[model samples]
Target: MFTKILIANRGEIAVRVMRTARRMGIATVAVYSDADAHAMHVALADEAAHIGPAPAAESYLDGERIIAAAKATGAEAIHPGYGFLSENPDFAEAVEKAGLVFIGPSPRSIRALGLKDSAKQIMEKAGVPVVPGYHGDAQALVVLATKAREIGYPVLIKARAGGGGRGMRRVDHPDEFADALAAARREARTAFGDDRVIVEKLIEKPRHIEVQVFGDRHGNVVHLFERDCSAQRRHQKVIEEAPAPGMTAAMRMAMTQAAVKAAQAIGYHGAGTVEFIVDAAKGLKPDRFWFMEMNTRLQVEHPVTEMVTGIDLVEWQIRVAAGEALPLSQNEIGLSGHAVEARIYAEDPACDFLPATGTLHHLRFPQPIPGVTLRVETGVRQGDIISAHYDPMIAKLVVHARDRKAALSALASVLEETEIAGVAVNTAFLARLVQNSDFVAGKLNTRLIPRHQQALTSFPEPETRTMATAALAASGAKFAPDAPDPFDAISAYAHFHPITHRRAIRHGDRTRYYAITGLGDGRFAVRSEEENAETLVLPAEYGERIVPWPGHLTIFDGPDNHTFQLHDPLEQAGLAASGSESLRAPMPGLVKLVRVAPGDKVKKGQPLLVLEAMKMEHTVCAPHDGVIAETVAEGARVNDGTVLVRFAESNTPNAGRPARRNIEPSRL
Candidate 1:
């Protein structure tokens, strides 16, 4: 094994790689940008180096800088974790040229599968069944349109060089083909710097099943079962499981063989994943699966595979890069139990899964149970900030059990017990998803979230108990020290009668007045507009407030953490009037395009600007029909809630004409 290796990435994946390297007695070096100077991964590494600024292009993607840092630190190998430069063939080649071992697939193997169109052709020739699509080299508008029609309606236009759901679109009709192609190309160019695309038939009710394959320098390869990544939102996997719920032995064997074949055909020599799109409109069968793409590096969902197969994929990657043979043959590898992984992201599910960035005032995961297997893979601390410059994934929660049912139940319990504050998160959404009847029954597909939209996306109002607790905390109620019993700690016997205090608290969209009365002897009576008065005992301490806000309180109510804003009398009076009209950014990001100008008329729901953040684009629309009073230009950096466009509240149209829709920005 190599003595020292540098991790050419950041975030949880970097920390994950370091953990294994450290355990194996290998020194690890971490490279960071300005934004990640104090990042968790940097603090965990044996040595750290600053590459460049926060922008990935200037730092993480700067191959030269990364190579120099590796050499300066005397790293014998470089492990490019799952994102940034991990899948870039040129970067892999560059690492080898610098006399450092790249701890992944060979550069030649990466180039073979870098482009989707070319990879499809290679798979077809290797006898690995591929999806029926047009993978030709023609890059003309008419040619793509013709191919989409030939593939039938509901065709998918995917960027030949894209992943992570970027630069891809689904068109259900011929009329929408042109628009979909144009949009796909634009996003593809922005994301991958490649405008080439391929058209494929869209499978209905598809389940994403990918097999983990490993290879060695001695031309030996083996497969590690499969993972079902069907639970998704916006074409991205949200939850994944190993030893697919309803997988049959026959189907598993066939898929595993096909994966190994694909890997060996490309001369693959490291960890890689062969993703297959399964047509589950019927049921999972060997013939119903087709090749989607091959990720030429370690996957984000590799933990689930590790739990089931009892194999250390990272350890194998290092050993193979050091010219070792395969650790085990295909016949010897077997799965023992079921494992499930939920990707906990700093995103608001109610806001269409918009990525959120903020300081993590308080963050905690549930402690492992005695008999249950629970693992948390994260690279953040309590005071760390989730920045817009990188992916907003907070952690991966993995649980293992004897069967799928036990694993799912344990996962749901773990998600509920997890606590996070200072930003909106999808913890509640994930808990609900795993407990859904259909999900529990293993009836999963790519459309699971969309099919259960109402139940999964609706944010519930705070319970009465939660509100009462918030009110008491905001009113400065504390436990009295000179009490005979613990229950009487909050009761001050100085007053013979109960003392009443009124305060206003805001929870979501509504603010209500609550009357809190101290009954002395550690008891208090609370009354709110929506609930009857009730007496309750006070605990010595409420939850802590991680943020520096004076009256803001983060209280744990059962499994969920509720953050309530204490109404400020002085600041509430200066709020904007109901008639005020302005379009503000919902999150901090760079203004990619502004479609309107001052005095331009716009209609309600008309897209006026596009903001790019967290590797995704969000459209800001006009909330009402009005004329633009002022607007910002494209290429401007803006913060969350920054007013990008001001509008006149008047109902009259500008220049006696309605605004044209041709210039409206596309919806994300």
Candidate 2:
């Protein structure tokens, strides 16, 4: 094994690699950008080096800078952890040329499996069944459209050089093909700098199952079962599980054999994943599965494979890069138990899962239950800022149990006990998914989330008790150890036996007045006009944060976090300013495209601009039919709520009158 290695990545993956390297007595170096100067991975490494600015192109993607840092730190190898430069063939070749071992597949192997079109063709030749699609080199639109028509409707246009669901679109009809293709090409160019795309037949009710394979320099390879990653949103995997729920012995054997063959055909070494699309409608049969593509590095969902097989993939990667033989043969490798992993992201499920950025003022995870196995992989700490310059994934929650039912149940409870504040998260959504009947029964597919949209997307309204608790916290109620009861300190005054405090709390689109009365001792009576009165003891705080500006208080209850703003009488009495009527950027991102100019008329819901954030494209639309009075130019980096377009009210009775416009950006 190498004595020291450098991790050429950031976030949880970097931390994950370091953990294994340290356990194996290998010192690790970390490279960071300006934005990640104080990142968790940097703090964990034996040594750290600054590469460049925050943008990936300037730092993480700068192969020269990374090589220099590795050489300066005397690192014998470099591990590209799953993103950024992980799958880049040129970067792999560069590392080897710099006299440093690249802890992954050979550059030649990467090139053979890097592009989707090329990889598909290679798989077909290897006798690994591939999805039927046009893998030709023609780049003309007409040619691609004709191919799509011949393949039938509902074709998927995927970027030849894409991963993580970027640069992909599904066309349902011939008329929609042109628009979808144009959008796919644009996104592909922006994401991968390649505008080439391949058209494929869209499988219905497809379950995504992938086999984990490993290889060594001695030309030996083996497979590690499979993982079912069917639970998804926006074409990205949300939850993944190992030892696919309904997988049969015959099916598993065939898939694993094919996966091993795929790896050997490319002379693949180190860790890689061969992803397959299974037609659930026909069950997991050997002939019913087709190769989608291969991930040429360690996967984000590798933890589940580790839990089931008792294997450390990172350790294998290092040993193989050092020219070691395969750790175990295919016959000796076996799965022990079921494991499930849920990706907890800083995103809002209600708003099309748009990525959210903010400070993690408070972060907490569930305490481990005895006899139950649970693991959390994260690279963030309390008070760490989740920046918009990187992926929004905050952590990965993995749980293992004797059976699928037990694992599913444990995962739901774990999610319920997890607490986070200062930003939107998908904890509640994840909890709902684990507890969902269909999901529990293993009736899963890529469309699971969309099929249960209403149940999974709706955010529950804050309960009356939750609002009352927030009101109490906001009203200067703190946990006092000297007083036996929580209300003892506040109710000490005999003259104020039944003090009543009224506060207005807003949740979602509704605001309700809460009347909380202290009943001495440790009890309090809380009531809302919309609900019945309930008397109870003060709830203990799991997490809390107080902001002085608008007197906002946030409290955690189960899986839900509630924020209440203290109503100001002065603001209600004309001290506060009116709202604005302009289009604002929903999140911090780069303005990729501006579709309208000043004074141009646009209809309601018309696309006005596209903002690229967290590696996803979000289109901003006009709120109403109006003329653009002012607008920002393309290629501008903007913060959240930065006004991008100001509108002039259209065809109103006061059309000639000047309207109050607040186009200036406001600091939060």
Candidate 3:
């Protein structure tokens, strides 16, 4: 066994690996980039080393620098967690050449399954059924287009070297194939530096099911059952559950057998997940599932597998890397209760689930609750920044219970209790999704989110009590960001006798007025327009009912975290505001392409430029028919709210455009 090891990753996965290492009495080393200097993963390591700058290419993805850090720290081996260099065969080979153990599959095994086309061929040779697709080496346009036609309409063009939904596209008709293929290649080239692609038949009502398999150097392999990742948005998984809700005995037997066969075929070791696409249009059967691809390392949703199987996957990875045999036979491994995991992200669902980035000024998660095994796997603290330099994931919230119903119920409650500020979050969206009728009943698929987007994406208004709480906060009863407590003297602001005040708060599109009266002794009477006066006591330091900062305050509500603006009277009377028009960046990103320039005439919704951030691309479009005055140069790094394109001085045409408010920095 290794006395100490180095983790070649960042964020939650790194922190997760360190936890297992510490528990096993093994020291761990962590590597960080300039952006992650104060990150949670770096602080949790027994030793740390600096890699390079903020860009992943110069830091996390720099395999040589990572190996050097491992050697300098005297780590016996290196664990490539989930992303970064986890599945890179060249990096694995280099680590072996450096006289250190690479705590994962051998380079040969990685190469066998690194590309989707080759992996399909290998799986077919091993008798593991693969999805029907064009796995050819042809890269010409006519060749791919002909293949798509032969496979029929509604085909999927996927980047051979991509994952996490990047460099993938769906074409519904023959006319759409060319554009989709071009887009997929562009994304693939940017993300993986490989533009090769494969065309596959798009399955209807597809339920994504993956089996967790482990192998050892002794050629012993076992299965850890399966997880259903059907609930998704934009081809990215949103919610996952283990022991697929409607799985049958016969199907489970067949899937597990095939998974073990695939791993054994490649002589795989350590952790691996064999993903499959099931045709749920009918139902799960022995022959309905087809192998999609194999992930050569751990997945982001590994916690759900651990919850149901009562196993430590990270520990298993470490032990297997040390040449230990399989811990248990296939028959000894059994599934217990159900487990569900929801990815908590800093994103806004209303705007098509765009990822958000900012400092986490105030963050709160749930504690260990009763009757549920809760695991909050995260690498971010309250003050850490969810920067654009990396993924915007905050944590993975996992819960296990006796059944799927109980598990879903518990997960809903936990999401409601989660409080976050300074960034948009998908907490409300997740809370609603768990209680969704189809989701609760397990009628799941990749289209679940997109089909029910209206109900899931619309943010609801605050309740009466929540508004009353906000009113109390704005009254400055406990703490205030403006003047000191007026109740202390009651001279000028309080009118010397009946201390009364009125506040106007602006929400989405409307403003509400509240009448407040100071009742003394940390109490206030607050009344809205339609509701009667309600007296509520303020907890010490105002509690978490409301979070007040410089210019705004956050109120926790059921449907959303309602942050209201208490506008200053002087500022409102200044002017109607200059309405100069310009297209600004929604978040910090790199300008990938620029299609418009000064004096260029563009139509509404015309793609003017593309901004890439967090591995997702969002196109900045013209708001209305107008002539562009100036545009930001291509290849320039920009921050949130930076003007990317400006309209001519007298050519401001915002027809059919909604009023612009404060732009929240978010993901693509």
Candidate 4:
């Protein structure tokens, strides 16, 4: 193994690579931007270097700065963790030319697969089952549209240089083709600096199954089975699992062979993933799959593969980079158990899934259960701001169990017990999805999120009875001073002792009264006059209370607590502030373009502004058919909920529809 290596990335993946390097007795050099000066990855590394400013283009993507940092720290090799410069062939070649090892596949191999158009042709030559698409070099829109017609409707317009779902669009029909193509090209140009696109036939009910393959300089390559990443949102993976459910022996063999062939064809070395889109409308088949693309580096979901195969892929990366052969043959590697990984992002699921930013005031995971370790890979800590300059991902939570059902159950419970504060997250949403009957049944596909949008986006709208009960319990505990504790009120009323305490609680559109009958040990039992009683329990870690009698509500724990927060029914409503005059930016970003001028009459839902953050463009629309009084100029920086514009009420009441609001969203 090398004595020292530099991580040319930030966030959790940098921390992840550093961890494995530490275990292997390799010192790690971490590079950070202005926003990540105090990042967890920097603290964990043996040494650190500042590359540039907060913007990725100035720092993480600055190949020269990263190379200089590596050389300054005496790192023998550079590990470009999955993003930024990971797939940049020029950077890889530069590293090698500087007499430093690029701990991944060579420059030639990356160049071969980095461009989607060329990679498809290569896959076709290798008989790896390329997706039926137009990978031609024609740049004309009419030509591309003609190719889309040949490929049929519901075609995917994908950027030739895209990954992570950026610069991709799905057109359902011919009418939407041109607009989608234009938007895709604009985003492709902005994201990848390439407006070229390829049209592909969109498979119905597709399951994203990717095989992990590793190669070394000795002409040795081995396949590490597959991971099912069908659970996705906006073309990005949400949940992933190893040894795909419902996979057959024949199908697995064919995929494994194809993956091996793809790697060997490019003389690939180190860890790589060959992703395939499986047509699941008719279930699994040996030939019913098409190549999606190859991730030319270690994947975010590699932990699932590691949990099942009991092999450290990072170790293999290091070994291969050190000029070693493959560690194990394909037959020798056996998948032990089912593993599932849930990406925990700092994002609001209810607010168009916009990325959220805040300091992590509190963060903790439930203790791991035996045989099921909950691994949290993160590069931030309490009090660390989740900067809008980078990915909203806070951590990756991975769990392993003997079976898929067991793993799913374990993940569900863990998600609920996870305590995060100071920032909104998708934890509750993830918990609900894992507990969904359809999800538990392995009824998965790319459309899973769309199919379950109602359940996933509709947060718990608890009934008044439940809300009142909780409020009374929380309020009673807060009001009582020396009472044997208001929590004791639950059991205080024996079947005969009739003492009822009234409390008002509001949930949704109605407010109702609840009579509390008992309270003890942070538990309260209450019932509406016409409903049955219900008991509630709040975790003790939040705080403890001891009341002698009723004086004034004395509180113990609540949202103010460090570790836990009661599920506030109005939290979502508060976050989704809608109405009236002002247009607020949904998250921190720079105003990219402004279309409406002051005093301009704008129609409801008309695009008035665009904000670029986290590598994506979000258009802000007019809140109503109103005269714009003010608008934020283009290229201005704004924070979450920052008022960018104000509008005069529309002259026509509820013109065409209810007043629409524009909330520019942040990227994830």
Candidate 5:
């Protein structure tokens, strides 16, 4: 084995590759940009090199800089983790010319499969079935339009250069072909520097199934089963599972053999995935699957296959690059339990799935459960910033179970417990997806997410108990359905035997006040708008999580997750105040003590009240010497601009202002 290797990519994959390299006693080098200086991958590598700035063009994609970094670090090989320069044939050839190993397929193989058009042509010549379409190299838009006409309506205009649904457009009718072709070309050129495209007969109900194929220098190859990536949004995979549900022995044989044949024809070496589009309308059939394309490197969803087969693909990649023979034959590899992987992205599912960028102020992954293995592959920590310059993938959560049903159930529960703050995520969306009737029943397709957009993308409204849970979680308490509730500390001794905490929580377009009367033993009587007080009890099977931060709180009740803007009475009172600044709160914190009462004369700069946050004391002072017109209750939790006290003046502008007023949202 080589003494060391350099990973020329960032994020989870780079971290993933280094781990296997380390296990095999190989020291690894990492190359990073300014944006990834403190990235988790950088910290994990044995030796690191700074390539360039944040922009990929100036950094990760600059092959020369990467080669230089490897040479300077005395590394013997470079592993291009997927996405950036992973499938670039020239870069692979450059690595070989520089006397360093490229831990992937040879540059020749990449060249044969790099472009969708040429790859499809080669597949046809190799006797591997391909989707019927025009794979010719004609650049004229008129020519492409002609091919689209011949292929019939509903032809797909796909970017011949790269994948990820970019540079691809689905033209449902001839009238939409010209405009779609233009848009696809523009996207392709901007994304891959190649505007070339291919017209493929669109499979109406397509299931994206790809087989994991491996080859070595000795001309031997083996298949590691398949992964179903049919759960997608805009052609980008969201959930992927191994041993595709409902795969029969005959169909598996045909698809796996075809994948191997495609890889073998390219004179392939190392790891490669042959992706096929299956016509799911008629179910899996030997003749219904056709080759879509081949990925020249490790896939983001490789973990699912690894979980099912107990093979480390990265190890295989390194071994094959080191000229080792194939580890196992086709029959030697066996699939075990089913495994599924869900991509945890830093994006909002509600807002067109737009990418979100922010510091991961709070990030927590699900813990392993009985009879299931949970793996979280990530390169970000709690404080890491999700930058706008790169793909906004936070992590990949993989789980393995005895069967597909158990695996799906565990995944849903785990997703429900996932807590992420500061950036919107698809945690809730993915949770609902796994439990979706069609998905759980094994009815999947590329259009699954798009077809069920309304149901999957929409977050369910939280119940009154959920709001009560949010309040309790914010106060630093956790409740398990079966565990005895030990919440006496929050209960107050008054004329009554119990204490009720009333607070207003604003979620979505509505703000409702909840009354949570503690009844002891982790139970409460809760009431919300237009609802009577009901005994709140979480089912023995729990699907609840609460994450609280400054001025905000998030509650997850099974399939429901929502962030509430906590409304303090102080804030409601402060908003109506136009008389003095003292009525406004300085920050979100607890009102520790109120020194003066209403009508009390105070001197300018005198300490009014003590507010506490982060274990520190901050005293509110008098804005000017004046008589106090009103004072908020002591020991109240308040947000910024929450009215603390009002000064009596000629301009008692908001003394009688109603506490609740119609609040209009800012135009987005």
Candidate 6:
């Protein structure tokens, strides 16, 4: 094996690689940007180097800087973790040119599958079934429109040069084709600098299944089964599982063979994933699957494959890079148990799923369970900042159990105990999803999330029994002295004068007041306008702060507890609007595109501006029907709450004029 290797990435993946390298006695070097100077991965590596500034282009994506760092540290190989520079073919070639091994597929193999259009053509030659689409070089409007018609209605327009759900659009009919294509090309140019696109037939209720294939320099390749990544939102995977719940032996065999064939076509070595989109409308079958794309590096959900098969993929990557064959063959790898992984991101699920950035004041996971292992791979520690310069993923919460049901239960329990403060996360939302009846029954597809959107976003209110228990616990020690008038404090003032105590509790939309009545023995009866009467019992062995944070309380009733997050009532009184009628920027980011001008008229819900932040696109919409008063030029960098546009009261002749501007929204 290589004595020392440079990790050309950051975040949890860097930490993950360092861990495996440590286990195999290989020294690891980490590269970081200014934003990640204090990151956990940097501190964990044997040596660290600063590449450039905070932005990805200046640092992580700077191939020359990464290569220099690797050589300066005397590293023999570089492992590009899943995101930045992982799939960049030029980076792979650059590392090899510098006499350093890229611990992944060869540059030639990466280039073979680098571009979508070219990869599709290659797959067609290999006899692997591919989605019927126009992958030609023609760019004329009329020609592309004809191709869309030939493919049939409901065609998908995807950028030929990029992935990650960017530069992708679906047109359900001919009338929507022109605008969709224009918008897609604009985003494609902004994101990848390539405006070329391919049209494909859109599959409804598609289930995404990807086969994990690994090879060695000896030309030996084996498949590690497949993972079902059907649970998605906005084209991003949220939950994943290995040994698909409803997979049959015949289908698995066929998919595995196809995956191996694709690997052999490229003389691939190391790890790569061949993704296929299956038509789930009629359930999974061998013939119903078609090639989607190939991820030319290690996947984010690789842990699920590791949990099922008793093989460490990272160790294999190292051994293969060291000129060794795969440790195990296809037959040697066995799916012993089921594993599921939930991606815990630093984003809010309720508010358009916008990415959030803040300091992590508190982060903790409960003790791992026996017989089922819970792995939390994270890069941030308490008090560390989550910046907007990188991906907002906090960690991948994975669990393994004997069966799918057991895995779901274990995951739900772990998510509940996982506490993250300062930055809003989707932990509670994920817990609700795993415990959902439909999810437990394995009625899964891409639409599962949208089908259960309401229930998933709406959290359950605290149970009465749980509230009562919390009240009892919050009351602290109970007194019953042997002396007379032991209840003096209660009796002296206890004329049943409606002893009411107000405690603020938040459930969903708003925080409301709760009335408490102490019933002896650390028990109390609680009532809210929305809750029924419930009893609470304090734990026999309790602390002043069970949940370990003040201003909030978690009451363990008979068998459950409810956590009530408290909000300061005075915060709203101090709130002030910074600007005039113009809509302000909600976060710091570059203005990717300006859709409106200074005097363009727009309707409600129209897209007015687009901001690129945290490596994702967010659209700012018009709040009401009005004429545009002002707008920032494209590519302008703006801070949070910087007004970019102002609307004038509409004065269309047909329709009466809008009300006066002096009248605010509430008054109007």
Each candidate's TM vs. the true structure? 0.93, 0.91, 0.92, 0.84, 0.78, 0.84
What do the candidate models score in CA lDDT, each in turn? 0.83, 0.82, 0.84, 0.79, 0.81, 0.78
Error of 2 at 198 (Å): 0.6
Pick the lDDT winner.
Answer: 3
Pairs that collide in candidate 5 are none
* lDDT for each residue of candidate 5 in 1-668, tens digit (9 for 90 to 100): 89999999999999999999999999999999999999999999999999999878899999999999999999999999898899999999999999999999999999889899899989999999999999897778789888889998889888898777777888888888886786677567756889889999999999999999999999998899999999987678999999999999999999999999998898899999999999989889999999999999999999999999999999999999999998888788999999999999876677556555667878988789999999999989998988766888898889999999999999988888788887778888898899999999999998888789888887667766676666555444333434344444333334656666666776764667766565445555555545565556432223566566677877656555678777776866564654343455533556766889988998866777765432223456665578888888887987645777777773433343321111110000
Which model, 3 or 5, shows the larger TM-score?
A: 3
The window of 10 residues in a row where model 1 has the poorest summed lDDT is 654-663
Q: Candidate 6 on 1-668: residue-level lDDT in tens?
A: 79999999999999999999999999999999999898999999999999999988899989999999999999999999888888888899999999999999998988878678888888899998999899899987788899999999888898887566777877898998897887678777766668899898988888889999999999999999999998887567899999887998888988999999988888999999999989878777889999888888999999999999978999999899889999998888899889999998886666556677777766776679888988887887888888888888898999999999899999988887777766667887788889889788888887788789777877556655444445444433233423264331221224655234556655334555556554544333456545564334343344532452455554322112345656567743333222235666655778877888877878877887777776556777776788987788899998766666666653332121111111111000
The regions of model 1 sitting more than 4 angstroms off are 481-498, 529-551, 558-560, 577-579, 650-668
**Better candidate by TM-score, 2 or 5:** 2
Worst 10 residues of 6 by lDDT: 659-668
The better candidate by lDDT, 4 or 5, is: 5
Judge candidate 2 at residue 56 and give its lDDT.
89
For model 5, the stretches where C-alpha displacement exceeds 4 angstroms are 468-505, 511-544, 567-668
Against the true structure, what is every candidate's RMSD?
Answer: 4.4, 4.7, 3.6, 6.3, 13.5, 6.5
Top TM-score: which candidate number?
1
Over 432-535, each residue of candidate 2 has an lDDT whose tens digit, in order, gives: 89988999989989999889977887866666556777666656554354676544455445473655666676554355676666655555555665655565
Ranked by lDDT, the better of candidates 1 and 4 is 1
lDDT of 5: 0.81
After superposition, candidate 2 runs with Cα above 4 Å error? 478-489, 492-502, 509-517, 525-551, 567-576, 598-603, 624-627, 650-668
